[model samples]
Target chain A: MSGPARTPAEPATAPALEARELEVRFPAGRGRWARAVDGVSLAVRPGQVVALVGESGCGKSTLARALLGLQPVHAGQVLVDGAPLAASRAGLKAYRRRAQLVLQDPMGSLNPRMSVYESVAEGLRIHGVGDEERRVAEALGRVGLRPPERFFARYPHELSGGQRQRVVIAGALVLEPSILVADEPVSSLDASVRGEILALLLRLREELGLSLLVVTHDLGLAWNIADRIAVMYLGRIIEEGSTDEVLGEPKHPYTRALLSVVPEVGRLEPVVLTGEPPDPAAIPAGCRFHPRCPLLRSGLPDEVVTRCHGRALPVLPVQGPHRAACHATDRASADS
Target chain B: MGPGARYALRSVASGLGTLLFVVVFNFFLFRMLPGDPIGLYTRGRNVPPEQIEALRAELDRPLLEQFVTYLANPFASTINSARYNQPVWTLIGDRVWATLLLVGTAIVLASILGTWIGIRAGWRRGERFDRVSTGVTLTLYSMPEFWLGMILLITFGVGVGFVPGVFPIGGIITPGVDPTSLAGVLDVMWHMVLPVTTLMVVYLAEYALVMRASLIDELGEDYLTVARAKGLMDKVVRRRHAVPNALLPTVTLILLNLGFVVSGAITVETVFSWPGLGLLSYDALRGPDIALLQAIFLLFSIGVIVANIIADLLYAVLDPRVRA
Candidate 1:
């Protein structure tokens, strides 16, 4: 057969979920707001898996929330299928049905008092979906829970960590959302179970053509399953590209520092970033990541160092499917 | 037996043992209190030597023998009230149902209203309704029961000359009224309003506060975020996901409150002069009536222990994790 033809109703090339110049802020105190997610833009294409990698407070999760319309965006818009998200009640509800969220802790994410069936069927019941029984069972089956009846009556605590996470996924799948935004989904699971969950996500994307936006702090997770990677530092995406391109040849200094610490089997020289990420409320001027950038301290040319310390960096295009927001990289490319 | 069954059985056995200790302790402690029941019964007037001798013989038995006899036939009306010239159990039996009715009604009302308020307050935390309700309930909770009862009694019972009183000042019903008739029933309930209101106001805050605190804790849980992410309306998230989990700890609190129902609220009952166990205990304290006091203590302790056992069983049923 030839390549799949686009349906007339929905443009095939449209992204499943997209965010443009998204910003999320929380009131810090004393009339000051801390920007959790600063002017950022991203997109999850139909049937592709994108991993959003960052440190603990880097706002990858915030961006994920914004994508699902769970968080109120302070600035910019989140688009679904190339259309601006509607702010009306009915419109928001319809949008929510197209996007769903999976949280970090499986143990804490499922109501311990509710049975697996109740948990899985909750979303279906909320959106007033019909044929709930078959839908719930089918969702569970797709999540690798065979004969879902065995788990129908069991509470969350009765299940293992892996099974609980599968139930959480089943809860998400029951809605049949096109985009599944998972925030550190496997961070709370065992190492053995983490692979199984990641594989399940990959398998779901393949079978259902579902778009996935996975937010995580683990570089290894991005390498394992992501088709593309976006590295966020202090609420900004510093690097974006295909997984192999970005991980193999990191153009952004923050991305390089992050990848340097991912314990490789044979690599000896590991670059360790000194100092913590600056407080978001008091983010350093110029590049937000310049405070901890190792390249800035490597005795670069005086002009390059001044630019790094004083000027804002734009996401400059590198070789195919790769971009980074760093002045040092620009200078290096110019010199070469 | 399974471990859960064994655990339940063990709890029951321990509860029964505690009840037994309370019984012995109550019996002995009352006997040791200063005051002679016989003297109180006779009103310090001259009494025939034979009658005095008989009263002493009935009450002055060796503590060990009395306890053993009580153990052998605990339900028998062996203990007599010092002032009433009747069995202590019989007198308590008359008042126990009334006490239960008043306190039971209060507890039921408090739980339903309190839990509802808590759910609302916690779900929309920091809203005006939450702030106002929390403040009002806390103020009501802090007021003394007797003081609150007196205030209700005065305002509703002894209104200003222009505005007449709406409720009775005290008593369970009008004196010498036929209790079975509709008019009598109305009278009893009318009198019940002040005392019940006092108890309800105080207890309502407890439940509301506990439920609010517990529900607030549950609301912060990750499950609730997942529930919201499921596209559920705010109310649905709270009722389906948050309430059940929050209600777990509150269950134990509610059951314990039910247990306290048997004893009745002494201060409120006294302020109303309601013929309940609390009033009976209060009077018996003045007479230093050992038999009556001991009987009331026993009933109160039994209520507490039984309620606790029921709570434990319900907890296991509600939370599967506790079954282990």
Candidate 2:
């Protein structure tokens, strides 16, 4: 039952979060600039969830931090609700009030001295929201802290692992923010509890019209909750499209390898990648995924090698508006 | 025994062991020196046979026999010093309180002033204020306490003629005033200035530096990041979450360091010639005061042991994480 087939709440007029040609690089010990997030451009509409999935050093957290103005970017602008994030003092303050982050490690993120009620009420007081009493009560209620009276005064140390994470989520929601950048939010949770938090986030999205940028390494999160998917590797996005397209018919070789690794509900032995992902700091020059591309066609027909290793890498379109970054995908398209 | 009582028992046993060794070693070693307490008692004067015999009986008791007697009766009828014909406990009882009040005030002032500067500099991180704090703390931390005392003496005691002389410098009270009088109390406080400041500047630097390091490290914790991400002002994020968490380790350091200063503050008193435990112990180190030396050693050991215990108990009250 679709439960009355409630239409997803309408998204806001302007994009919730947008970044143009975002590039971040650090000065190497030897005077060269090492790229972290190279030419990464993304947009998340209000009330829609977009999952950024990648291996550890794919600049996922860097991207998340820049969204919150925690990290300074070298080239490009991050706009929150149509205003530049770092334009001026007033703009920064305005951006902070609208965009919030749900951190990864719930246990480490909740201060032991803060009670559940105090932690939830903190954000409301910061943004100068409605009555402290009613808002904190409502937030705890939404997070499923049943008989909210029991947990309202309890410290973080007293709560179980799952409960601590729920309190963290409540803290973010109390501010009534427009966009929540959940940076690896559920990665540190147990398998049984991860689903509950993911569902809670999805429910909050629908009921509140909040945008979500869920940075994760799990394909399951993308499949379960994301409307769109962006797959990154070595600090660059290799694929982007609807969730079904990326999971059902992955376009790039890297995207294909990532999907092959997901463990099905009743299946055993998830597919293993042949090697660890390349270091982001020293990404391969031409087609960064060339070293591990299973479909590289080792004995390339000279023509294809000349193009792929020589200079030009092509873009190919796959199912449902999917875009893949590879010469192999282009060659495959011509062969088909 | 309950947990607290067991810990207390452990502490007491340790104190008794240390005292036993100090008393026995000082008793034999001091007697082995050139002149004996009996000789000093007579002052090379001819005394009646019965008086000499009474003094010898007191001195001839075996070191272990005398020590065991003292342990059994720390508070029991006390022995009289043959040199002064006064109760040994009575002399100790008179001096110990004055020393504690003076040194205790110095340590408290140092910790409060040090912790405040440390938190301010640490919260600001990399600013001109932070740099100034580092320079000042390191400079003052390395300056020896006695040298600082001498500098104060030259400036305030002699040059400016603020105070009359150096003999009563930073001590209990002037020789003529009765300690019960308000004037006498005021005189003691006046004397405390040089000694308190000398030790305060010397040790406050170490506290500020140690606390600064701890505060900087705690500032990187995930909870503080989460606090910042909650749309809270930077000031609130730093004051509420960062400062208290950082101060936890500094509390333990403050406790251990207080014990060091109480015992280590001798240099300041030595330079100033103040009549406190530091000056008293230095005189004992010279000669003709074996019993006094042993008594002072015993008291210093007890003060250190008590300070450590207080540090342990303070843990539960300061950090909620520890109570759990």
Candidate 3:
């Protein structure tokens, strides 16, 4: 089948969300500061899936919160559909109605106290969608909870892990929101259940014409899900590009190391690095990745290292908007 | 049995056992007091040896016999001296409705206001509104119940003079009035106004404080965050989720307090001179009327048990997961 039909309703422009020079910080010891998200800027266009990839402590989730208005941005402007988000409480609430969150833990996200009907219909009720029961049933069917009557009256506890996650999706989609911020949505699900849930997310995005900000630590999870990927490290986006360019030929030393290690199952490899990621509180001067640079894997692996010697690596464009935070050579193949 | 019903049974059993232990301890402690109840009844002046012997035999024999009978049957009947040739059960059966009406109105009022104020304080916790509610509750909670009654009396009764003891200032009903009649009912309510108001304010404030704490704790739960993100307004969220969960703990406290209400709010009862259970209990205590005292004790225990059972049932209804 062809992609979604573009009605006359399709807006002239499709910029769903935009952030420029975004910054978020926390108070550190004795008036010092930690830059959680510093001068970071990105756009999540309508109908585009931008997956924010990072390790556990990276600021992808923070970025998601900031974008969703769950966490306020300290030093940047957040624009949703070309409207600055800070002005109206009512308007912001309206914007929130347009943008929803699907939390990480499938098992824990839905309230145990609420029935599947209540949980899924929560959005419809808030938006004052008419015929709430019919809408709930429709949304449940859309999420593949077939024979919706069987599930609607049941509580979250009665549903399996996959069903619970779909309930979350149904809740968000029932509002017909244009943007969905799925923050590690399937990370906590069993490996077997993860595929079906991910496929459901992909199908919803295609059918509903929804823009997605999918945050995940798993590169493999993002592999089939995102059109583009943004890799984060130490609370900053160190590398970002189209998924193929970033994953196929990694640029950032950290990204390279991360990619080199993804094939094995839970393999912790000893790799070259200047040092471990500098403490967020005491960010090393110059490049944050300087200490952990494999360029210094052994006594600073020959100045052959092009980037991450000890300076902020530029977001270099490789090909077709593909970018990384390193000027380093692909030393693995080079050494070979 | 249903899970909730089972839990309720366990709780009620524990509460009754505690009450039984307390009664036994208090009964023995009353016996240890300085003056003998029989001696007090005899009064100070000496009489003929036969007269003294006869009075002692008549009073002491009854008191000992009554205590033993109470141990055997808590619901046993005794004579009501206030109403000549009437049984104590007769008084209890008649007065219970009056007492229930008075305290029941007060309990309902207290719960509504307490929960509302408590939920508000909890919702925007640390805000000025929260601070104000906290302040109001604190002042009300600390104000003695009798003192509150007196203040209400002075304001509505004495100060404005519109009411001007138009309501019964004290005692259930005025003398020569039938408590069962419409006029008697009016008089009871008139007396009830000050005491119920006093108790409502005093009772509500403590519960509000407790509820505020519980709701505030509930607000911190991840479930509440999910609800908020679902775009539930603060009020609906608190009422639907936070308030109900918050009120769970307060149910037991309020149930226990129900016993206190029927046993007596002596000070408020005295301040209003309301002829309610509290006044009856206080009088019984002073008179060392063994039958009256024992009856009051038994009545208080039964009231506590009933209130607690109601609380359990209510908890089950409010929270489905408990029943599940």
**Estimated TM-score for each candidate:** 0.91, 0.80, 0.73
lDDT of 2 by residue, B224-304 (tens): 888877656678887888887788877887887666544556777778666666776676666455566656666676667
Query: After superposing candidate 1, which stretches have Cα over 4 Å from the reference?
Result: A1-12, A265-268, A315-320, A331-336, B1-14, B31-46, B58-63, B160-165
lDDT per residue as tens, model 3, A1-336? 122232222235736886666787787879987777776667677787778887776677778878877676788778887777854667767887888888887656666567889888777777677899898888899999999999977877677788888888888888888998898989888889898888888788789988888999888777667777788776667776776677766777787777666763234463544445555667665456666777445444354444344455442221126555543553332332
Best by DockQ: 1
In candidate 3, the second chain superimposes onto the true chain B with a TM-score of 0.78
Better of 1 and 2 by DockQ: 1
lDDT top scorer? 1
DockQ, prediction 2:
0.53
The predicted structure with the larger lDDT, 2 or 3, is 2
Please tell me how candidate 2 rates in CAPRI terms.
Answer: medium
Per-residue alpha-carbon lDDT of candidate 3 for residues B1-324, written as tens digits (9 for 90 to 100): 866668777877887787777566545655566766545544454546786576556446655674575566656563343322246666666666656766778888998888788877888888998999899889989988887888787777666655454454566667898978999888767767777888788889988999888877777565565566666776777667666667777877787787666765777777776667777667766666555665677778777777776777777676656665
- What tens digits encode model 2's per-residue C-alpha lDDT throughout A9-51? 2344666787766778877667776778876777787777888
lDDT values, one for every candidate: 0.83, 0.74, 0.71
**In model 1, how large is the Cα lDDT of residue A138?**
97
Candidate 2 displacement at residue B51 in angstroms:
5.2
